[model samples]
Target: MPNLTITEMNNLKEELKKKGYKLTPQRRAIVDTIIENEGKHLTVEEIYDEVKKDCPEIGLATVYRTILLLEELQIVYKLDLNDGCSRYEMVHKDEIHRHHHLICTKCGSVIEVEGDLLENLEVKIEKQYNFKIKDHSVKFFGICQNCGE
Candidate 1:
């Protein structure tokens, strides 16, 4: 688990500018919402709710479009799971995108875990099973602590 920093945000904004992006006031508000909620992976609806506080005229469709643009710019990453709407997090992966998470099925709680758990398994599949693996995503689902109670 890591925190999003102002420095990273600055870099992202600069990157966006280099790519001919104009930061509209509404878009800035949306990006602020995402940073203010660093570790909490948020869906478009959730982001729109937060963005609305700053830009009352902002629409859900605008949020969706902004999210898609940011994702294309690699300023955001979309999380894929078997359930629920897509959630997004801001990340700049210059190195290995090496994080996995556990998701609670009942309450939709997400817990971050590290340390290349799939590395050895991927290697074994390539060697023993003769399967050349490019990449993989794994998300375990179960009842979370609060939900279990």
Candidate 2:
């Protein structure tokens, strides 16, 4: 992920405040985990385990609530890779509206593919079907190089 600018950081804080939310230490830690591990697509249990190392008093329920709140605020994007668990990643403020995913069926690894590969396709679909595509997500399932051997 690109480095976060001061303005973006301030805007996030302001937005939270506007929503009657405080930037508590727990919340900050959770956000940091998501940002630092950008494309890892971490699950709630994974996040809770990581946060607990630093904040022992934090509970699993608290982590779940924080993740749900972050998702609601658009600070993080929830991903469902058909892996039977919901994963999340930080939202890149200046990138394409969404990112694609490469799912390794053998090992269940997820690789993020950057760039909007569907711009032209979306335009064609919109014109042909008279549909306005607001948001889109794509996932390609295959065996990773490591697992293919």
Candidate 3:
């Protein structure tokens, strides 16, 4: 989990205010959970369960709605590992690029691959097709170490 500084939290609050959205407790709780579990690639149910630990009154619908709002604000990114559930991770503003995913088809485990694995490919594509790439997402599916045995 990435450590969120006070300034970063304030920036997120300011962003919400600028978008004409108030930072409600429920929304804050959801964001806190995501921040605390940065690289987990949590699903809606997983988020809901974590939020419930502190605020038992928090409902699943609230978690879903908050996630949508976060996604719209680009504070969180949605991921599809092709395992049926939609996973999410915090958007690290300090990072220059996003990471890739390694998914185990048999066990449904997702792993994060850091660094820009597509930099060379993006550059080649840009030079060949005259198209600039802003971002990309890749998911490699195969049997995990435990499952391969």
Candidate 4:
């Protein structure tokens, strides 16, 4: 879990305001849970379960709606690992492109790969096809060390 600085929280609040949405208590709980569970790629049900601990009155529908709103605001993005579940992770402002993920097929674990590993390929494709590149997602599936061992 990554600790969100006060400034980051303020900026997120401002973003919500710009979009005509208030950072209500339920919404705040959802966001805090997401931040606290960074890299976990939690699904909506999982998020709801965690948030219900502190916000007993919070509904699953509210959690789902908040996640959709945050996704629309680019504060978070959905991650599909092809496991019949839609997970999500926070969007880092500093990242120009989404980072890659290494998925362990046997143990069902996800490891985030740091840095952009496709810059050269992107440049080449852009030049060859005269196309502009914006963003991309890459996932590598294989047996992890623990699974292999």
What lDDT would each prediction earn against the true structure?
0.79, 0.85, 0.86, 0.93
Regions more than 4 Å wrong, model 1: 1-6, 124-135
lDDT of 1 by residue, 17-106 (tens): 998988777777888788888778888999999889878999999999999999888778888766667988876465255368888988
TM-score of each: 0.77, 0.91, 0.90, 0.95
Candidate 2 residue lDDT tens string, 1-149:
23356886787788789888887888888887777777789999999888888899999998999898888888888899998999998877776667999999899988888799999999999999999898898999999998985
Q: After TM-score superposition, what is the CA distance of residue 97 in candidate 2 from its true location, in Å?
A: 2.3
lDDT of 4 by residue, 10-119 (tens): 99889999999998988888988998998999999999999999999999999999999999999999999979999999999999999999999899999999999999
Candidate 3 ranges beyond 4 A from true positions: 1-3
Report the C-alpha displacement of residue 130, candidate 1, in angstroms.
8.3
Put down candidate 3 lDDT per residue, 75-128, tens digits, no spaces: 999998787889898888876677888888888877788887788889899999
Best by TM-score: 4
